[model samples]
Every structure is written in C-alpha cells, then in structure tokens.
Target: MPEEFRTTRRAFVGALAATTALVSSPFVRTAAANETFKIGILTDLTGSFSDLGGPGTGVAAEIAMQEIGGQVLGRKVELLIADHQHKANVGLALAREWIERRDLKAFVDVMNSGIAIGVNKLVGDYKRLAFYSAAATDKISEDACNEYGIHWNTDTYAQTNAVAASMIGQGLDSWFFIVADYEFGHAMQASMDQAVKKAGGKVVGAVRHPLQTLDFSSYVLQAQASGAKVIAIASGGNDTVNTIKQAQEFGVTRRGQKVVALLPYLSDIHAVGLKTMQGLRFIDAWYWGMDDKSKEFADRFYARFKKRPTAVQASVYSSTLQYLKAVEKLGTDDPGKIRQYFLNTTLNDAFLRNGRLLPNGRMTHDVYLVEVKTPEESKGEWDYEKVIATVPADKAFRPLSESACKLRA
Candidate 1:
C-alpha cells in the first residue's frame, strides 16, 4: 500500500475509535435557549469537504436569514454548526445533541451519505427536520428513508446517470473509475457502473482510494494503464481535487483520455483552478453563473465567502430560506407542519428552481450538464462553468413508484 493510503486508513480507524469513545461518554444536554430558533448544520467541517462546504454553508445559512429579514417565527434564527469530521457516530451524536440540548428546530448540511443516514433515525426520533444539502446517498430516499430527513440536492444516482448517459451518447464508451473507498464513493461507482452498462458503455477498470488521500499517483497510473477512453472520478471534495490534479500532471488527459468527474463542485473547480480543470464536464443541480438569479445569489455569496459558492452552499441558502419562510407563515417550527408545507407547496428559489419536496424526501429539480470553462473563456475568476444541457426535473430523479417511502406514489 502507498504511504498516503496507509496514513489515511490509520486516521480513519483512529477517528472511528475516538468517535465511539466520545459518544459513549454521558454528557448532560445543555438547556435550550428559548429566545433563539436554532438550526444546527452537521457536516464534514475539518475533513476533506471542509473547503468544499464549511464556511460557505455557514455563510449561506446566514445569508438565508438575511433574505428572510433576519427573523423567523418572531425569534432570531441561530445557526449552530459542528464538524462531524465525516464520522458517522459523531454526526448521529450531534444530530441528537443539537435537538435535545440546543433545541435546534432543524439540521442542515449533512455532507456524507453514511453519516446522513446515521443521523436520520436521530432526527426522526427527535422530531427535527434534516435538509441534506450535499450528501449524495440514494438510500436516504429509499431503504433508509426517514420521515424527518429531507434530501435537498442532487444525489449519486442522478449525477451518475446524467453523466453516463451524456458521455455514452458522445461515444466515450470504455471507462476506468477512481473512487473513494466508502459508502458515498461506492454508491457513486455502482451508479456509474450500472448506468454505463445500461447505456451500452463499459467499465473497463476501477480503483478505490482511502478518504482524504494525499496522493492519487497510483490510482492515476492504474487508470492510465487500463487504456479506458474516459477516466471517471467517483469521489469529491479534496479527494477529487487531488485526483484531477495528479491525473493532469501525469498527462492522463493530454494522452487523449477524458476525465469525467461524477461529483464535481464549484469549490473543487475553484480549488483546482480553471487553468487546470478546463474542458471538464460535470452534472450538478446548480451553477452560480447560469442565470440572473444564480449570478445575483453568487455575487452576494462571493462577497461573503471570498470564493464561488458550491452547489452544496447554494442548497444550504435555498433550503434554509425556504425553511424560515415556512416558519414565518405557519407561526410554528413544528417538523410535521414544515414537512407537509414543503411537500404540498412548490419552492422556486435563486438556487433550486421549480423544485418540490417529494414524498421520498427528495427535493426534485432539473439537473444541469455543465463544463468548466478554459481560463481564456472565463471573463472573471469565479466564471468557471458553462451550462451545456439540462436533464428535465421529472426525468432527473428516481421515479416515486420505485421508492419505499410511505407517502404513496
């Protein structure tokens, strides 16, 4: 095993042990502050996704409050954020502790699918809402569905299917996958593998890397040797960034191969820079430069974050704004009321347009096929993506008929 992989694996095991110890200890739940209506954001704060989500998500929540005139249900809305560090138990513990101790009405920004589901039962038991802005697990809306869990953005299946269909149509048939060895990565790889075969393409080769891997040199070598026409990266956050950068350095793309990222985000592009990430095509639910609404939202977000907002950050802003609006109109922060309100009404916002909160907890919307612009094509720093095609909302997500959600089709 490579040194980076060994290091990351050790850290992963250590984190698990530490998280188990932390959750086992009995700590008194803090008294709830009745003066503030709080929403806790549980995400991978200090881990690989921190640069992709952390400060931006917190800022997005604040921006959502400002959009709501800084008050909801006649109380000052408070944003409580914790870095679960991508540990499942840590996320679950925070989900329970945030509600029981802090009296947060809802939880937002759960960024890992495994952790998202781990916290699902806690959110349901506590009767607190969870809007998954970045987590990409499909089972959150399927087998692991929770009444209080609201999947607010694109999931693994949608992105994988969208990219697979588009690429296969263009005749980029044979593929090699570089994936993170975990739930989110596995799901993405599985989705892409299935989609490729179904679309008459082939997954010729694949490899898995540990989370927060420092180097993807070996993975890139394996992908290159596979002679696959397309090297599909089924990872995100820092892992995705490193893989693409290393692949470029190794001339993987220059050698007549395309690198298709299954989970590319604005933050990842920004981290990699347009100069290096040019011509990369990705499928996502939002883009900051796509329209007037997106530009307006992006400009404000850029002012606060000093960087372009990722789709995850955009979802945080939209979902929180919608949640506040629900509380403002209903005169309560009740989860049942909020869930019904979201399900029954349509939410068209600066980020998510014409989306409905589905019975299976999916926030359904159109998925866009976007490409990273070349540095010469970019008019400005954050002018990263150019929209190419759109997958219709009705056709974007999984059909309700196939879902196990209690809410009938």
Candidate 2:
C-alpha cells in the first residue's frame, strides 16, 4: 500500500473499531437506560369515558411537565399516551407494551375501573408506579389494592357521601336508582343505597342498564313509575349525560322528580349542556375555577386547549406532578422509596388539598358538592358548576378501620 493510503486506512479502522466497542459497552448501555424518565398516561380516548377523560388528561400531564420545567432527576422526560378505549384487553396490552418495551416507569389517568384495575395489576407485577387518576371504583383501594398503585381521583365513597348528604338534607328523600350495569356503576349504586338508608331515606326502586345504553326511556319511565321524589343515576361520563338527556325526552324531568348524577364530572355536565343538567347535584374531586390556584391553572389550560378542564384532567396533572416531585427528591426512580414518600407526604396542589396517599392506595382529599348552573344563571361558557358543599379529606374515603386492604389487615 502507498504510505499515505496506509495511514488513512489505519485511522479509519481505528475510528470504526472505537465506534463498534462503544456500541457494545456496558457503560454506554447503562447511559442509554438512564437517558429518559418516561410516564405513560393510559386513558379513554374514544369510549364512554372519553368525554370526561380523553386527550385532556394528556394535556394536563404536559402542563405538569411545563410546570416542573420539563425535566426530573436530570433525565429528559417523555410522556407515552394511549387510548385504553374503556376496554380491559386493550388497556392491558398497551400497558404491557409500554412497561416492558418502552420502560414506562409510571402510568396515569386510567378512566374505567375495569381498565384501571388491569393496569394496576401490571404495575404491581412489574413493581412500577401508577395513579388511578380518573377511575372512581373504591374496590381498587380496598379489595384490589396494590403497593405500587395509588388511586388518586374521587371514588364512589367521596362522591356519594357529599352529594347524597346534600340531597337528603334538602328533603329529596325517596329515590329511584338508574344504574349502569358494570363494576363502576354497581359500586356507585351500592354506595348511594347505603347513604340513602343511613340518612333515613328509602330507595323505592332500582334498575340497571347496559354500559352504553343508547336510550334511557325505559329506565326513565321505570323511575317515573317508581314515584320516588328523586331519581339518582349511578353512573359517570357519557352514561350520565345520556340518562339526563333521555329523562327530559321521556317527560321524567317534566314531572316533579329531581335528577341527580351520582359521580359527575365537569365534562359530563358540559356535554349534557347546562339547560339539561341544571339543578342536578353532584360531587367532584376538583373544579377548574373553584379557587385562586384552580383558576390560575384553568386559565393556562384554557389558553392551551381552548376548553375548560374536568376534574379527571386535574387528577392527572396533580398525581403526575407529585410523582415527579418524589423522583426529584430521591434522585432516582426507586419505586419503593417513591411509594413511601407518597404514603407519608400530605400533598396540597391546584387539584388536591391536604391530601394523603393512604396505605391501601387511596389518595384521600376533600371533594366538593356542586350543583349545575342554569343556562340563564351562567356568566359564560364553561361556567357550569356552583359549589354547594365541601367534604373534608378524612371524611371523604373509607376509613382505614373499615377498609379491606391487606395493608390494613
């Protein structure tokens, strides 16, 4: 070989060898592993829960990213979001792929209780962290509780006690229950029944319809025939919206019966519109324009999405921010230490106030009982709920003594 050519070839070979070694080196592998702190948001995007928990939850997480300055523990943050579609198999499949393939360290905003429980199981199995940001089934914090999962938003217990108590106190005593025939709906109906009986009211009758009943005429007629002074719809999201709208069509509302949403989200009221949902009472975990901090966040959120956020979106923002805070303090994503920090700390934020993450995975916080505003009473669009009452944190959930969490046992 010519002398100059030999020298050039040697330099090229050395560079190529260095690159090859770098690719196979353990140090490089570890660096790649620690390059990103990823969080997955598994939620309903195109299903019954979508109206209340669609892309809005993802937007909430992004705002948390902005608020946290876009980094945690010196690692770049990445958000992985997917539509669970309110299906168990779909949610579990997406969760498994994210956890195993993408190293998704945490998950948020699973809307359906069935899907939330499935994702919780995955988080438990992988010893990862997750927050049930939108699901309301209390069973996850009780019979199905796990160490790595925190059930953050409002649940059946908090919602029922506050809204039901207010309605009962208002002398809306006798009730007819129209419930969705699913895990979440059943749990809510049971809670509503307990509240009514405890408060000296009677559940005159009850009926269960399929998950996405296109028409609630028969159910509304049944409720009207029950002759109960109040009709309680033990459901959420689209189910609640459809029931209320159909009740009006069937003359159920034309009569004197009061319609109540047992687990209402701001989005549900928005979808059903103030004209239809007005006078209906419900409880929520957070209201966007409730206070100074809430309004501040809501204004930013509105600036981005051009629509007001729901309690479910607020749940996603708060839970994800709190988890990131733990990761920063510990300087690593140690699930055990993060879980301990969550269990021990009292969190106060735009979405929650003096909230405690219970040992059984229930994030306990005060919730509000709000009545939907009438069309004429509203100042502008997105002004839906008017706060009627507040239920404190300690009183908002199932007590540790009454819980079935193995942690309690």
Candidate 3:
C-alpha cells in the first residue's frame, strides 16, 4: 500500500481500538442495555474529510447530550463513534454492527454520501433514525430517502443554487469547474451546472480530480486557460483547502478569475487563510458568528474543541439535541413518532433558524451567502465570513414540487 494509505489505515485501526475500549468499559457494560439510548456517529475520522467532521462531530453530539443533562426519556444517553476511513464498506459495516449489537437508536454525522445513503437504507430496514450532518449529495433526501432519515444539514442543491445565481447575477456568468470525482462533487457540479444554465450563464469548461488529491496545478491551469470568469470548486474539506491554496499560488484569482467554493466549510476557510480565500463567495447553512445564540453555542463548543464549530458540526449538535427533545416529548424512542414530530415541527435552534423538516426527509432552513473576509477585515480567530445575503428556507433548497423523492410522490 502507498505510505499515505498505510498511515491512514494505522490511524483508523487506532481509533477503532480506542472506541472498542470505551464501549467495553465497566460503565458501558454495567448499565442495563435497556436503560441507555445509544447514538452512533460514523465519520471519516482519519481521512481527508476528518478535519471537517471527525472527532469534532462526536464532541458536538456530547455537547448536545450535556445540554439535555445526558439523559433522554429517562434513559442515559451514550454516544458511540467509529472511524469509517471514508470507505462505503467500512461505514456500512460499522453501522450494521452498531444496530445489531449496540442497540443504536440513531446514526449521526455520517459525512460520506455513499455511507449516509447506505446507512439510511440500513436504518430504515430496522426502523431506526439517521440524522445526516455532513453528507452533501441530494440523493439522501431524494431517491435514497426514507422515513427514518433526516438530512439536517445542507445538500448539493442547497449548497449550489443561491451562490451560483448570485455569482451569475454579478456578471461572473461563464464558469469552469474543478470537481472531485465522487458522489458529492458530481452532485454539486450538476446542481451548479443546472443553476448556471437556468440563470442564462454557460459552463466554459470543467475538470475532475480524484478524492484526496494533493496537487491541483493541472486542474487550476486548465481552468485558467479556459478563461472562464469563474472557476467553481465542487468539493469540500482538505480538497477545498488545497484547491484554493493552489489556485491562489498559481495566480488564478490574481488574473481576475473569480474562484467560488460551492460547498466550503468554515474550517476550509480557516485552513486556506483569508489572504488566499478573501473575496471568495460560497453558500453556508450556518456560521458561528451569525447571531447571539450561534455565538453562545460556538463559545461553548470552542471551550472544549478549541476551534469554532463549522456548519456540519453545529448541525450534529442541533440534530442530536432536537432528537432528544422529540423523544422527551413523545415519551418513546420509536422512529415513527420522532420522525413525525420532526416533520411537523419548526426547528429553532442555535445552529438552524426557522428550520422545517420537509416531507421528503429534507430539513429546510435559511442559508447564507457569505464572503470570505480579508485578514485585515477579520476581527479575530474564526471570524472568517460576512453574510452577503440570507437565502430564506423557501428559496434555499430544492422545491418540494420538483423533488424526485418517492416519499412526496
């Protein structure tokens, strides 16, 4: 195996061992299985997406548990975490194990789209709930959607729609794309393509790169040569950080080509730095500095994790807390009851404002069109974005009338 793969595997093994030890400890063993509510978080703990939604996702869930006094419906809540290494098979296996043996009541923070879709199906088969905080593909709320699944965070259509239209309106009409060759990237780019065309803009050119790619020079050069007014990045996490860094190094932006990150996290901007990513625009579901409630939650989250929470991390926290509230209100952990409560209720939380769970298993909420602040413009650490506009819940996501989900049909 390549050294990188070997190193990643080693780290994953270490995480798995640690998780096993935690779960097998006396505290977990002595508790009657019926007295605990277990929520499993399957994430890319040691892969390229780790920084965006790894250990922090678990921390977010724990914070949610603490907010609810670590008990729900008279049952002590426990969190189980596993490193899926960004592989579909590894993620599915972990989800299966948790459901069959650990009595996992729900699955959260599934970052990989393939894994999220698979887990949604698995949980549906067994009548459990899944809250997706990181998966980006719209399929989770569309073709693969189930009554047991709730896509709490943003999806491909939500991520691309507002930003693409806003940029196109700014006269940055022609576009070229540097897409990650995966489900997330493919969906994001397709969304962007559709949005751009609908807005009367044209795609000049596009290039696809493998996941976890270190060098983006070829892709950046191709986009620069295309001379498109905008170079759209249809990826996230380290891939986004690296692409932005290299794009700046190659003077793609200096040459007057606007580079837009279709699905960037707050962590991505932090990694790339303001000087490189400044003036870049993207759509986001939440920002830590957006409001007083957001700031309060972010302060507490930073106190433990030492980093401001991203939208994905915040979603994990909000979804966990809300799920527990649903259980409390209904007096049971039944998937059907909790799912119904979520769909009928308007979710108002520090991380999501006026959120509504759609019939298609999509949680619709207001998303922001944010611009990266320059280093001088930033007030302090984690103060990276300025909200350029707020796309209301009704306009931010794909309209239910046009949804492909069978649930709606």
Top candidate, metric TM-score: 3
lDDT of 3 by residue, 363-399 (tens): 9999998889999999998899999989999998899
Each candidate: RMSD: 7.0, 10.8, 4.7
The CA lDDT at 267 in model 2 is 81
Worst 10 residues of 2 by lDDT: 1-10
Model 3 lDDT, full chain set: 0.83
C-alpha lDDT (0 to 100) for residue 209 of candidate 1 = 94
Please identify which of the two predictions, 1 or 2, would achieve the higher lDDT against the true structure: 1
- Residue-level lDDT of model 2, residues 260-303, one tens digit each, is 88887888877888888888777778888889999998998887
Off by over 4 Å in 3: 1-34
Report the lDDT tens digits of candidate 1 across residue range 1-409: 0011111211332332344334222222112356778886776545678777765687787788888887776777766666676777666776676677667788767878788888787777777888888888787887788778899899988998878888889989999999999889988888889999999999898999998899899999999999999999988898999999999999998899999889988888888999888888888799988899988998898776567788899999998999999999999888888899998998898888779888888889888989889999999777889999988888898889877677636
Q: Is 1 or 2 the stronger prediction by TM-score?
A: 1
Candidates in order have lDDT scores of 0.80, 0.78, 0.83
Ranking according to TM-score, highest score first: 3, 1, 2
Question: How big is the positional error of residue 70 in model 3, measured in Å on the Cα after superposition?
Answer: 0.7
Question: Residue 183 error for model 3, in Å?
Answer: 0.9
